[model samples]
Target: MNLLHSALRLASAESPPPNLNGVVSTPDGIVLLGLRGKPLPAAFDMTQDGDWILPSSATTAPTARNSYPAVASIGRLEDGSTVFTDLEADSVLHLVGNRYRAAELLRNIALELGTSVWAEDLELIVVGLDPDLTPLGHHKVETFDDLRPALQRFTDGLDLSVSELDTGQDGAPARRAAGDPSDALVVTVLVVHGVDLYDERLLKDVCERLLARGRTSAVVLTSSTATSLPGPRLSVDEDGILADVEWAGGHVRAEQMPQDLAVSLLDVLATAQAPDEPVPPAAEEHPWAQQMTIDGAWDPELDEPEPAAEPLPSPARTTEQERRLVRVENDDPDLDDDLAEWGDTETPARPLIAVLGEPQVRAPGGPPPIRAAWQIEVVVYLAFHERGVSREKLTTDLWPDNKATSASNVRRTVAELRPWIGKHPTRPDIEFIPSLSTSGDGRYRITGHLLDWELFRRLRKRAQARAAAGHIADARADYLNALRLVRGPILSPLRNRGYAWLNNPDQHHDTLIPGFVIDTAHELVDLSLAEDDIEKARWAAEVGRLVDPDSTHDSPFLDLMRISHAEGDTGAMRQYAELLLAERDFEVGEDLPPESFEVFNRLFPNGLGRAVDDR
Candidate 1:
């Protein structure tokens, strides 16, 4: 017992005792069949009268997402901000705040699980944990009021930890007239059984996500987790029978067993769990710190100061929040003289994304014409951050009010964008310019990143180091090649007009193809809608309403009209929540956030939630 008495006996052990009487029950309030209530489900209780409003239902009911919320707060929403004043429910958030909180909780749980069980499969849910855990403390993370019965009691009942049996056979995997090949060394043995044995730092965080491909091959093993229970759960017949692995664990450990073989060996020794994968763990905290705890609610104290956020009419694809640095051929000449005294180059940092295709609006009339408001806003904000963006958040997102006439229309759109940028023989002394800063002093400064935003920061750091080594199908083929080059839109919207990108400003670089096609249709609807896929949740709500026709009345096309009203039609789910509150005015807009419409009010329950219950 050395290392300082094993670090003072692992700091007097922690966690396990605070189960708060382990309540855990579930299900309540509204969401009858769509399911959601578990923890944070008590927000909306509206009802007006004249102008007939009426929102009342969500007091706490939610039970359908892979089930279990009773207190499930995953948190992370940035796409332009505003989930309770621009996000901040910190549990964790890494790779670009886990791709902006996994594209807003996988598009609100793939439209409240249209294909059920949080569908979207391009994988990458990740979550190993224990980097000295402490966002709230004692493993604290239970804030769900309603989210499908606390995600059906934490994905069918949070076992927490239990798996220890591998009696050592050398090697064993191929078991069939088919996959039958063996060496028999299957050791899992984990037992953090609700964490205790001197609180082994989250069971050594399951050996930091197991994977060993090869290195003096004992198949190169490690992560052993367990306290007991790598058996049981039978019921198999149709020829691939084992009568329950011969009455549950008594013979032929390997041989013709692909079917239930004791529920495929209880899903092969269950105990690798590590779900809530956000992971930022506060690298100086950023994901919006719970939207800065209502930081004066943007402007209520001064009796109203929050009115600014509207820009992007193409002073070259404007809108840049923070993470827009994009550095490549680093010489550090004071960061290349702060990127040429501030033209912000290095091409949006290069990873190789590709989602493009926008440019067909303003047609049905005659007026929308007068352009060149400084050469298409610096040639569409450096071709919408070299074709992929969701950050670097430009001032009021591209010039809201008048950051000095949007920095004099971005220094006169970078003097006709130094003659249309074209060459860069892989960073030939760098060039893809555009960037200025100023979210501080007296405020109002625009411009940022360009090196094709480092192809989504090098395919999200090589698909998160190939999913931390396990390489789940090569991190789902690099998240579908970083979501097909993310088509194009990170600043283009056919003219929000500007002092800085004031919303549309006659869209150049074609609103970066609907902001990289609705951010890769919300990251391919965050992977086939969490893996369920009601036809890819109606083709990711039809490419997020064909590149934003106001998201066909938003909330992912009212979650495809609540999955076509649960496959039937309670009058088309009350006419898709009374057509998103009569022709799309359904609460929360100054850019977006009424909790980003938590799955469109759990599935469209219109009526200005009585003005979000008057706050």
Candidate 2:
């Protein structure tokens, strides 16, 4: 068919479709713009594969505008003079009548549109169908919530198309991992029937964004009104004859073309272009378009979304709770009055317990003597210097051979101990064992007393620090003080009994003593040796060896042997060597360490040493 016939046929085919604004066709892609809930034309390229529809509004009557809300309905520009409002669910005439903030909106649209069009070779096409169509049409996109989801959908379609072209898979990554960013292009076509249908500010803003991107656009406007957008221009006279209208600001040339050019452009660009004579027919339904229903939750009267208010300031801190707890713990004179505000449901104050020596009462004349019982055993076992004792330790230490009864027995023992300690005058008002909330592993602790072992450890650590600082006198004083506090093995009176549950034949019987105590014994031995007190060193080493038969504690027992040799006590040296030998044999099930023999050789120069040399 000739150009005239083709033009006449295209013009005759044009008809007004409700909610269907117009078609936007680039060199390679097409987009359909319209109102929500309208069926698309079957004859048009409804591939849905590359189509994106932005729903303007529901076909409902306009509602009243609400007062200024949390979310700003209108945002000001950098100059603070211009205010932009949402176009979604609002009429173009209404928005234009109020001089809509089209420039700011258009700037955002341009940026988004540029990002959305990701194909390298398609020409940018903008068609104006209605002479008064605004940038938002009937839909609104003001904040991130409104724009991001729709923009993502459009980009997702582009990504899918690029993936299919590169790898023939729906969502597979593009094969060109290192491809230039420009190679993966985005081509967007804005379609409207008439330029006059859009707000003038919006038109100017759209033109500016396009020009900034170095794109020269073509506009179809009446011969009279001049557009600032510098590009190729097509003027249609009242008679519908196409004329090349020149503006002073125009840079790109436009040839005088027929008024039916858009129809021909649509027919050419919207249809599938297959290299072969025929292409396979597209599926009737696609997920992309099927999911494009208008999300109709627009309460027209409401204002734009605002930020949530900050929370009220918290009340000032008070020491009343601490004071109450302290008073209850100290058995104070005003305990009842101080605790009056605390209701029955409120937690009772916990006792301030001490365990530095026999777990006695630190408060003067508060509590009388604490009798020796399983409660004392529980305290010693629970108090591991700074570390918490394990539940297994409590169960085993309390009920050695009876595995089944251990858990229940431990519970009973703790229950009895709680009341017993609470009855003490020092902490009569406080619950000694506050709660059964132990660690994840069911470990327990004594809450009432300050443990002596903890004080001993702190003193020993301080002594070591002093020695390292060259304060020998201070260190010696601290060491003496720490050793004086030992009194006896960690638990003292209870150490001999109540640990039948420590029935580990694999470890020596002496392993019943906590490892921390054994370590403390080793520290004492070292301090004694450093002080050059042979008697004290011997005592400390013996205690360490007795408590740690496995020698796993790695005490300084060898130092004791060396000290014996230095003192010329052959018998004592031999005894220490024998002990060392026995320890090594226990550990490795082998002969004594060579260092033990060295001790013997040193003690008996010409005796065992000569015999070994002869061999």
Candidate 3:
């Protein structure tokens, strides 16, 4: 059932399966029908005379053959290969068996076809069978109480032109020629129960017409009584064994579905068919721009400079002679020189702890001799809360369920981690993690050390400042440095396992770190594009994509699309457009945003529909 759900989810986003004589092919071009017998089938020799290659031998049991037209497993061969049959094969398939067994086979086929990715364009017209398929919620399924109305409905839906239709040898109208069309052709499979009750002439006419139209197929549930329907007869016994399968050679046990499983499969397909909630419009603009700024307010002046104001005399200048002397003497060191000297001596060594990609502890010595996983988690937690966290808060967050020993657990963890973190580099007397009692306020926090996360933030802040000051090159440099520190998503090494506190909406590193990354990447992209450095722009966009591949914030994709457009790579532009469109379709069940559509339309004036048609 999980496999069925996965297949449905994947199939819903993709185009219909390529039509290979009514056989549904997976994305990998193989048809996975289901399991067969209890042992592996011997591999077929390549030197054999046959054009088709057989599956390789395996010592394992229940082998599934990936050959064509074999859409579902009916039974197992003596050699362990599955007996597959395409329920929607090109010709009409008449299932002759015990009434209940035949109906069960029909239900199984319906369920498989309904959930199959390859059958996206398949329309099932079920007549006279009440397997309770309404709960399936698939748009293609239509159940009728009688055969006459089902055939009438199927006939009325046909939209063939005069040139498209031709009289077959049996005088039934069929498709004249199979031409490659702009859209995928629909394959209608007419499933009928109790064929003897229907008018024989009506059944024969519909089957002939269906066979003439090469893309269509039919399956009829018939009693043991001879029926006028023309096709190979597959007999199912009361014991559920299928006999006289020409392709399968001998009889094999037929697959039947329990009513409960059919219902469950239908429910899952219904859920898969349900439309996804619309993605909110928040991602249309740069969501991170406001958050990445120094004052938490993005400045428009940073992007567009205002008019120069009237010049005013500097108050620091004494007179023209003093100003000239000051300029000539060059005795006073500028702010850049002073900051350079200070940076050379004051900038701390590489952060001892990193929470950017993996939660890592690079102690003064090679690797920290930390004993437990909790010790690393406690350090990362404290590092994230740079201001400091109280003993009560830390315990409650880290061990919410284990309250009685939470306080002691924190105490023990910090005590064990203290030695490994070593003494503060600048202040040797002060340990990296200060004892709770050492501080007047009983809050524990890391001191005299920086985390990679903190370093990234500092660099981003510097980049923001540089950009605001119109130092484009310097700002670009700072942004690149910040982005380099981001090896992956925040705390990716810990994943979702130990970071309970991270889920707190009030202090969410998940959103905060990615926001900074996206905003910085966008800044670099804009700077690079302004300088016509397409390679750098591409690098920045790719990095932004790495952080949020799902396009939770779609500005990164939009930036990439814009870059692709600039490069005049229409194919790449369309690829990005389709990705953005697919994301929107999955998340919001809607079209691309207007600006995004504009970019796509600019490249392909006829629209995405025409672009697809051209393909």
Candidate 4:
């Protein structure tokens, strides 16, 4: 069941299944490490000739793979027998050899043990290693800067486990029978890159104490200099091969994890353990429903006649009004010249499909003929994939479960969509040219119509280019212009209904579009704040929130908190802080992201004080 659960999680994270190729049957308590060279006499009783003898146990099923948490593979003999180590039974395993080789071998052991199916209750405390293992994101895997504190914590935990066992409620044997082996004395493995960092006496004392208990706890030490300690010592050569062991006649390749593969595996593990999908906000709670426009304009409905005396504008209101006026008046021709090279040739006579917000085909002639949801989807898909999608790929993605009818369905949908997309201005024969070739296997692509998303991307690119060239003011304008093109979230109309392909992590529209929106808004907010334009800053933050209502990125909420603090609005500051905290709750074991917590602490040194105090 554990193996099955891990496989399912890997699938969800879009990662390859675990490689179980070398896995073979092993004894119950012996634990299968990598293979060792078998004696010629031992090979006589084996199924195959050269690499046969594996420590077999009657209790273990013939087909069962290595029981992880209890087993670890160190290296393989030249004849292909895997060398096994019983981590649960072994109290201390000292790795001595070239510092770099030993460290690499230790890292591989940690990776294998950490990513095992039964590693949920396994705690790995690593010291003096700079490997970027954080991407694994497992709550149990931790890195410590100093050995003293980590050792102290380990001893404390050991004492607690020992005390729990003494209670006699349920001993380790009983817990193992119930299939919850970790209930008593969680499997904690301490991996130290350099054993010489601590006093040799203290290290030996700790290991001896752990060995005395005979629990599923152990310490793995790696060192460059030769040192004698209790338990087995495996010397690693500069080439990462095991030496001074009777297990082989030499030429054993150690199991080493490449940097890239480790990172990829860690990413897979992180994704598999990601927090539950956050619920979408209700329609009323959505940014669009809060009287806030995507471009940061507030369009409140008038409830009564205007007052005879004009009300004094708050700092936010004054800046917002001025910003609006600046946008309307085309007073600067130089800004136009900076963007002239990238500007569109001319506006389309027909309304282009709008996908930046709601998925819609705006045909100026009359109501669009595109009535089916699939028709709009087809057009939107082509608009995003300008390179064109093959018919098979499109059908496969769109109708994954109903492959038999998908080809016909896609053909009919495209046919219905092409007419509404309209013909190219100069080419009457190309009626939107939904397909590039007359051949049946030709690719499907939409042309002759512009996409709002494309325009948004163009403006954003220009803004970044301008900013890189040190044209701050022009860059700000470009960012604002790009933001104004966004009506709401990308494909807001298809929130829960369709477009399952967008959920893929590789899709640019799913990942990159939101990043672009958040970045643009964040930059705008910073620029506004730099100029002391409080209202503009507030507006920029709201625009960011409008696109990312879930507050996935911390910058938007952080911007708002700063804006509220600058305006001396404690009430608003507290609200933004709470929202920021909720959004950052995805972090495992941590209260908040570092930057968010820092801002929160700065705003409310006495903790998010009572809301009534602000009043």
Candidate 5:
């Protein structure tokens, strides 16, 4: 509460606003503060206890002209959310204020994008009047000194191609648009607080930095009836407050930012992340529907006309478009350079065989056809296409208990499967899955098909090797590709739902599927952490949860611990500890592991702090 109180004191000292937080720019000083807690003015609503910030005269003094004492407090509400006091007041303010609303908005954006924006997409910037008034101290943006380094650190080693902008310059944001901004979402929030403010230049620089971006949403939180910066002025009635927003080109609009505002903001994010497998025809009428497209909204002026579908390419010929789509999304420039040494390598020609999830076969750039049980089983045996299975081995593996009648069943299944693969009505000569070959020993082999699981395995292996060699960017791309192939557990529907009545029952997964998924997830998380990618690490843990919902191991616990530590979220820490206790008891039939205890001890060596008492 100390930081929040300090900010409030500063705000009150400098003609405090009706509510908390605002952007102030004077001839001698410019400060941006987003405060929370309660309304500062009695005329304003008293029900909202949010943080506050103040504006002060510009000066380069070492000590503050006025300083507030620290406030100590802690507790929780009925809903189990913790209440904070002392320096922890900033947390309470943010959790209850518009800052929390902004975070929720970002999450909703991620959901809409079919990608994560957690820590992955955001770039935060906080401009405080007093250096000590850092919000949560999670990752503070230290004015001019911090902007470049912070932005560099966040974007570094990422696929994002940031433009070379002179961030130290007063108004350098315009240059940032030259680089590709799609790699990550950059959101900079400037919070200025303190009585004796100095170096007002950085405050202006931060606003410009955000303005330079082609895509950005800016909102000004203020309780002032008269805003210093010229912009749109909102009229918050007795129960409301002013939110004056001023953008470039004198474009300004103001509005009421009360609890109702949150609902409106949420609608924007929800619309962006609408679940559309393939956007419906009617959806096109909606303004946000264009966002669902792969390349975003279609541009009638710049974009080419919609092209008719071309027939799938044969093994002998490759179209340029087909080649591009067939190749995995490798984001690393360095990896491309490394691969260049091997000459002009093209996407290897291979038919798409999906075995990791439901067993289905589809040609490159073609739709997946429904496959029979035996057809899928045969394809699984010839996973790499180059491999072959002996007729006896196939029977034993397919139906060991029914060995007496296995051969006839296999023969019947193969005969039925041939027409679907060997002779397509459109291309009579093209063999999606070539006729099975009988070796001298009567072993059967299916040629010209590639299994998706095998490809996923190869990609994971390559990523592992690249990571070992310290080619992190290359490794990340490979890991992403590998993970993308995992739609569900290996051989789903058939193994999990479709044909459980078959001789080979499902639910009992192949030992390989679960083990492979868990291992790959761990590797992905580890690699992501090494690259300082908390969001990717978080996503990896989610993938692990999908595969091993019971969390048979400690990876999920460790992941939660790491996430909580990075965010300085004590509640998350408590949740992680409780989960670990339950998980460990179930898995090992013992108390939580030493690692879990170590984290718990660090978070609450003094009996779980006030958080435990609330429970």
Candidate 6:
């Protein structure tokens, strides 16, 4: 590997440590490195993550001051893992498996934390993984963590404590009490190490919970030898954008990454805890028990799940996690384009619905009658409307514990939908996007030719516009039609588990579509309030605030109070204002509409309402 080789070649330390992958020494001089492929190192310390920073001068410039090359020669290992080859064989040396492992250990131990996945496994196996986490290479790690006892002997009186594993009474609590300099937050972060995109379920849970609470999130891949990462770190911050996670790398030329970039990618391994579900400290630490179905514990919690028992060649457009987006784990730049293609589910495919257009298609009990199975068709239509959902979610909703084969059932359902597809004025309303290979890269596409939901949206917009123009009848009709899409709570075939978190909710969904649903509700509330429909307005406002508490200033309840003022119902206005003020969660802001502010002032002369208390 050019990068690692260069890093080592430049090392100018007096009698510098060898450029082996797993070598370590404390501030004092003691060496540890793995010999051959042995599980344990010949001599070393046992810090879960070892620290290895090259001599500062050696790190930036190679021993041999060679200029950049258009095509850098990098070494590739068979196990899909790679290391940089430095031209400065003198100043820098390639550091791959063992070195990487040593770094992993030192950094973590410095942070006073344990490696979640390899806590007990001092022997590490470093494999090259593509951005999508596909194994491109592998290599056994020979590191200092394997020689905890020997290193302790060497230090004698050094200020340190290293161990073989972290799970048992590792004495962290004792260390902390003794002023080891750590807090509960640091400990919590330590617990979530060894997790990442590979843990799809955990990722979903974390993102959803965060969104529900209106808390901003960042998914930056960081680097640090200490518990905390440093440098010109890029954070996603409060804005919901994909750029934060994308900065690490689309595809890593594992063999050629600069030492800094390599360290950055390591951060993606996800040792820092981003809650699977934000369990309040007051609640059980782990609300959900582990259901271990896989072996080999490198964070099995985040390990890629096995394909469904029956891996069926799904109909065009159906994919699992079609929206996870494709990522490249290699150094290949072309990977981004290929990934983009997988995500653009929009296409010309017609709805997966059955058609009523076929002549003689309508038959009696002797034939596959027209409406014998309209349920599947409706479900598929809803799926299409949702921009596509995952099979796990769909199955969970449809057959919670039923063992019936899912493929056969889905196929049978698709067959049933073929007859009535064209019934909707917009035939393109439904479609099944194709999936990309066994890797499960994909996206759901809504066809441009479809006018179903868009028509409803347009009607809703027009209704709002006309209502402002005092065209009540027309506006009401459009509003009713737009709400028709809600015929049954966003519609998921998933039956019993609960789907409220879905495009349609019942329980199938793990959580609600916090952002989207909240926005929709608020919009509807604004319309209802403008139309003087106080009851509908208040209901919409409450739902909106529940979805996102920050929307308090614009909640429908507040708007209705203002309408009451214009209608001159001072009593009703006070009653509605009091109701809004009683909402336990909403923190009303000073930015309330001027009209609403006036009405609120009238209702609560003291600028505070205490007629009732919220739970």
Tens-digit lDDT string for candidate 5 (1-615): 132232222221122221112122111121222224322432222223343323332222112111111121122123222221222112111111243233332222222212211122232333322222122223322333443343344334121322432222321112222222432223333222220113223233433433344223221111222223322222322322112211111221111223354455446445644554641121222222221221121222222235437743333325543332222222122333332321223432334566566666643323324555655555555553244556676666655556448566777766655554454345666554444442444556655554555445556645654565456887788787777667765565564333332334322444346556666777888888777787987888777666564467666666766666665676786677567766654311112444554544444433232222221
Ranking under TM-score, best-scoring first?
Answer: 4, 3, 5, 2, 6, 1
Q: Which stretches of candidate 3 lie over 4 Å from their true place?
A: 1-351, 403-406, 586-590, 594-606, 609-615
Clashing pairs in 3: 279-588
The regions of model 6 sitting more than 4 angstroms off are 1-382, 385-409, 416-455, 462-494, 498-554, 585-605, 608-615
Best by lDDT: 4
What's the lDDT for residue 344 in model 4?
39
Ordered list by lDDT, greatest first: 4, 3, 5, 2, 6, 1
Off by over 4 Å in 2: 1-372, 381-415, 423-429, 435-445, 487-532, 545-557, 578-590, 594-615
Q: What tens-digit string does per-residue lDDT give for candidate 1 at 403-474?
A: 535455555644344334322446544443423332233322222332233333344333333344444455
lDDT of 6 by residue, 1-615 (tens): 112212211111122222222222211111112211223322222222221223312111111111111011232233222222211111111111233432332233222112221111111212222121111112212122222332232222111222211323523322322333322101111012222244223334333332342201111111221222211211211121112222113322222333354355446444332335521121111111111111100111232446546534433323432211110011123323432332345531233221211111121112344543444333433443444445554444445455437666754654454443333234333323332122143322222222233333334444444454455666565554544333222332343443323444432221233333344455566666666776665655455455444433444566556556555676776666656655533223122334554545444332332211111
- Model 1, runs deviating above 4 Å: 1-24, 27-554, 559-615
Q: Give Cα distance to truth, residue 587, candidate 4, Å.
A: 12
Whichever of 4 and 5 has more lDDT, that candidate is 4
For model 5, the superposed segments whose C-alpha errors exceed 4 Å read 1-350, 363-374, 384-387, 400-408, 423-440, 495-509, 586-615
Q: How far is candidate 2 from the true structure (C-alpha RMSD, Å)?
A: 35.1
Q: What is the alpha-carbon lDDT of model 4 when measured against the actual structure?
A: 0.56
- Candidate 3 overall lDDT versus native: 0.54
Error of 5 at 319 (Å): 38
Indicate whether candidate 1 or candidate 6 has the larger lDDT: 6
Q: What would you estimate as the lDDT of candidate 2?
A: 0.35
**C-alpha lDDT values of all predictions:** 0.29, 0.35, 0.54, 0.56, 0.39, 0.31
